[model samples]
Every structure is written in C-alpha cells, then in structure tokens.
Target chain A: AQTVTQSQPEMSVQEAETVTLSCTYDTSESNYYLFWYKQPPSRQMILVIRQEAYKQQNATENRFSVNFQKAAKSFSLKISDSQLGDTAMYFCAFSRYDNYGQNFVFGPGTRLSVLP
Target chain B: GAGVSQSPRYKVAKRGQDVALRCDPISGHVSLFWYQQALGQGPEFLTYFQNEAQLDKSGLPSDRFFAERPEGSVSTLKIQRTQQEDSAVYLCASSRTRNSNQPQHFGDGTRLSIL
Candidate 1:
C-alpha cells in the first residue's frame, strides 16, 4: 500500500511571494506518478501539477512547480508569484504506473492562505 | 460537458433515507472513479470503473454503498439507510484512458448532508 504524507496542516503566504509545500510518500513500486491538486471553497479538485517518477527533471506549470526527489521519496510543490487565487487546500497524491485502475492515494492536505 | 459533471451539487436527506448521486464523465473517457471527502480530510477512494465494468471497489466502506456505470458514460453512487457519518462530499473523476500516468479531471463534488 502507498501512503502520502503532508506534514504541514496549514500555511500562509503573502501575495506575490513564493511558497513551498512539502510532501512525502512510501511506495515499493519503482515507477509511479506524483500529483498536486488544489481544492478551493467551491470544492472542485483541480490538478496543479504532476511529476513522473522516471523523469529526472521536475515538472513546471507556469507558477506551479515540483521538486521531486525520487530517491528520498519526496515531492514538494512550489508556488511562485503566488496570488490570492492560490489560497486553497493542497493535496499530494501517488499512483503506480502499471495500475490501470489508477487508484490515487492522497495526503491529508494543507490549507493555504494568501494574505494581501 | 467539457469536464466531469456531477448532479445534485447539494443533497440533504433524513437519516435512514437512501440517496443517489450522479456523475457524468467526459465523453470517450474510459475510466471513472468515485471518492468520498470528509470534512477537513483528503478525498478517499470509493470505487473505480473501466467502461461499464466495475474493476475495483475495495475502498467502499460498507455494503450499504453501491455504485454503477451501466452505460459507461454516466455513473451513480447509491447509499442505503444513510447515517450522519455518510455526510460528506462525493467527488467524481475521469481520465482519458485507463493508464495511470494520465491525470484525472474532477467535477465539483456533490455535498451530501444527512439530517
């Protein structure tokens, strides 16, 4: 079984600043996928960024990026130039590559507040 | 719909009543998933379907829960004799294919409240 952990329960960042949310996972599989999802008050889970375990280079999507250290089993999300819209609950998820069902194990989540 | 669509964005039911939540996945999507999100908690997997076949349902908490995607496009999650513990947001997600690498698109969850 794979388990994802988000040590930070809540975080706050000033608008226009940068913030990093930490995440770690335990999985025996060598190939997998890591994802960060954001859920606002609307309760719509939106994909922020994703990283492939096989890729050495981190994944970047505009202001959202990830620091994926496969050996350490760590995948952290970084939000640069954060805005008020970035204030939401963030979750880290894990999925094995070969599993067609694509069952994702998710972390508890970190509530982020972007202060002006 | 351009993305996954869930019906009854908010549902309120009395205890012991049965409720059904609907989910319409993106056109041509081969995989659909249901998750339960309790207050202040991450979403937990409930079931999975590939086309119209239910591939996995180990995450369902109890026999009181049932899900079906008979036509493979629209899915429904039914809960019997709902209890206060059953109050939570039900999220539906779908992927273009069954491949694990593909990112799943989610719908605005249906919030169920048992009174």
Candidate 2:
C-alpha cells in the first residue's frame, strides 16, 4: 500500500513571502507520480504541480514548485511570492502506475493562510 | 465543457436514505475518478472508470456504495442506506488519459450531509 504523509497541519505566510510544505511517502514501486492539490473554500480541488518518479528534475509551475527526492521518498511543495488567493488546504498525493489508471493516496492536508 | 462538473453541489439526506451524485467529465476525456473527502481530510479514492467500463472499484468502502459510467462521459455515484459516516464531500475528477503523468481536472465536489 502507498501512503502519503503531510507533517504540517497549519501554515502561515505573509503576502509576498515564500513557504514550503513537507511531504513524504512510503511506496515500493519504482514507477509512480506525485502531485500537490489545493482546495479553496469552494471545495474545488486544483492541481498545483506534479512530479514523475523517473524524472530526476523537479516540477515547477508558475509560483509553485516541488523538491522531489526519490531516494528519500520526499516531495515538498514551495510557494513563492505568496498571495491571498494561495490560501487553501494543500494535499500531497501519490499514485502508482496502473492499467485502469492511477489510484491516488492522499495525505491529510495542510491549511495555508496568507496574511496581507 | 472545459472542466469537470458535478451536480447537486450540496445534498442533505436522512439516515438510511439513498442518494445519487452525478459527474460530467470534460469533453473527450477518457478517464474519470471518484473520491470521498471527510471534513478536514484529504480525498480518498472511491472508484475509476475508463470509457464506460468500471476498471477499478477496490477503494469503495462498502457494498452500499456503487458507481457507474455508462457512456464513458457522465458518471454517477450511488449510495444506498446511507449512514452518518457517509456524510462527506463526493469529488469527481477526469483526465485525458489513464497515464500517471496526466494531471486530473477536478469538479467542485457534492457535499453530502447525512442527518
């Protein structure tokens, strides 16, 4: 079984600042994927970024990026120049390569607040 | 049309009642997934469908929960004899392919409240 773990329950960052959320997972599969999803008060889950297990280079999308360390099974999300709109519940998810599609295993989330 | 959509943004049901939630996947999408999210918790996988075929349903917590995608585009999740524990947001997502690299597009979940 694959399990994702997000250590932070709550995080706060000032507007224009940067913050990082830590995530770790346990999986024996060599081929997998990692993702960071953000859910606002509207309860809509939004994809932030994703990383492929085989790719040594980390993934970056606009102001969001991931620090993926495959050996340690660590995937952390970094938000640069945070804005109020970035405030949301961030989830870390892992998925194994499968024929039917990937089965996502998500960690408990981290509530982020950006103070202006 | 551009993104995944879910019907009945909010649903309130009495215990033992049956409830059905609908999801419309993005046009041309081939994969659809259902997840359950309790308050303050992350979404948990419930089922997966590929082109009207239910490929995976191992994540369903109980036999009372069932999901189907008859035409490969629109999907429904049905819960029979719902319990208080079934009170959670039902989320639907879709992707262009079943590959792990494809990012999924999510819909604003249907919040199920069981009384």
Candidate 3:
C-alpha cells in the first residue's frame, strides 16, 4: 500500500560539484523511516543515510545528507563534493515497524554519474 | 565477513529447472529478509524471518517460490519449476533485531539468469 518515487531516472554531476536526488513517498502512517541506498556494480545495496519521520532534523553522514520534508512527503539526498566513486544507482526506500519487523519498499532508482 | 553472505554470486539455470539460493545472515542477528530485484528495478520484498519463525511471507510471488530458515541463521530460497520471470537477483539482508530503527545490512546478492 506504500510506495516510493524517484523522479529522476538519471543524473550527472562534475567532480567536486554538488548533486541532489529527489524522492517522494505516499504513506498514511505518521511514524516511519526514510532511507537512501546506493547500489554499485558489485550488486550490494549500501546504506547512505537514514531519517526518522519523527525527527524533523535532517540526517547527515559525511558528504551524504538528507532533506526530509515530512509534511510534503519528500526526502531528498544531497551529495556534496561528489567524487567518481559516487557514481551508482541510488534508491529511495521506505520502512515502518510492525509486530515482527518492518518491510522495505524501494523506489525505481536513479543512476548517477560523476564526470571529471 | 561481518556482513550478510549470499552464495553463488551468479547462477544460470534452464527454464523449468529448480534452483536454490542461500543466505547467511550476520551472527546473532534476529531478523532476516529476502528480496527480488529485476533488471533496472528496485528490490521487492519476498519474505521475512524472525529467528527461526517465518512471520511473514505475503510478498512471495507464487506457490513455486519457497523459503526456509531452520536454524535462524542460514536460509535458503527455493524455486520449483522456475520460469523466465523468476530470473532476477535475489538479495538477502539482516538486522540486529526486529526493531524499526535497525538498519538492514545487505549482501552482494545472487544473480540468477534463466536460459
């Protein structure tokens, strides 16, 4: 019943530049979690950053940070000083807890390329 | 490795053949999850396990798909009479517990190609 959307199919940024990937979701649950995952050619989905819906404060990890707008149902990732290694398929995911564990619902994904 | 481990990084099977993918979650992890990701698409939840109990399997695509975690650590996803549509990367993830805030650690995934 919950869905995540990544509007950008592909994006490119010059090295050392800044890039922001947009994401939005539809969910009635007021309490939930938003996440950004990066999947490289190696086939592993690595956690970039996560934001709790209850926390208005954005989440930051090194060069990766999230602009979480709960009311707007938008969660965006901003990568500063982008490097070549940042090139990957970035996915926006949603998860909310249940009696056992939460289920992860991921967006289509955005392919990012960092050029020199 | 400290992270989740999946076997046979790549698998090629003929149509209608049976294939089994393995996943080894992190030691002491209480929750494990399985997902299927098609080409150019995001991963979709297939099943979930809490320790040895399969609490949720609502995401499984069809009756041909089966998953089991007997010891609460190692798991296997078996597909019987596999079809072309079953060709996708099977991903496994684990977390410290069945908590909302716990981040899931993912394995590299097992890419299954149907020929």
Worst 10 residues of 2 chain B by lDDT: B96-105
Report how far off residue A4 is in candidate 2 (Å).
Answer: 0.1
**Native contacts matched by each model:** 0.88, 0.83, 0.78
lDDT for model 1 = 0.96
Question: Which residue window of length 10 is worst by lDDT in model 3 chain B?
Answer: B95-104
TM-score to true structure, per model = 0.98, 0.98, 0.98
TM-scores of chain A across candidates: 0.98, 0.98, 0.97
A22 Cα displacement, candidate 1 (Å) = 0.4
For model 2 the TM-score comes to 0.98
Q: After superposition, how far is residue B34 of candidate 1 from its true place, in Å?
A: 0.1
Candidate 2 Cα errors over 4 Å, as ranges: none
| Residue B90, model 2, lDDT | 94
Output the worst ten-in-a-row residue range by lDDT, candidate 1 chain A. Answer: A96-105
In candidate 3, list every pair of residues with a backbone clash. none
Better of 2 and 3 by lDDT: 3
Q: Please give the distance, in angstroms, between residue A114's alpha carbon in candidate 3 and its true position after superposition.
A: 0.5
Per-residue CA lDDT of candidate 3, range A1-116, in tens?
89999999999999999999999999999989989999998889999999999998999999999999999999999999999999999999999856469879999999999999
**Quality class of the docking in candidate 1, CAPRI style:** high
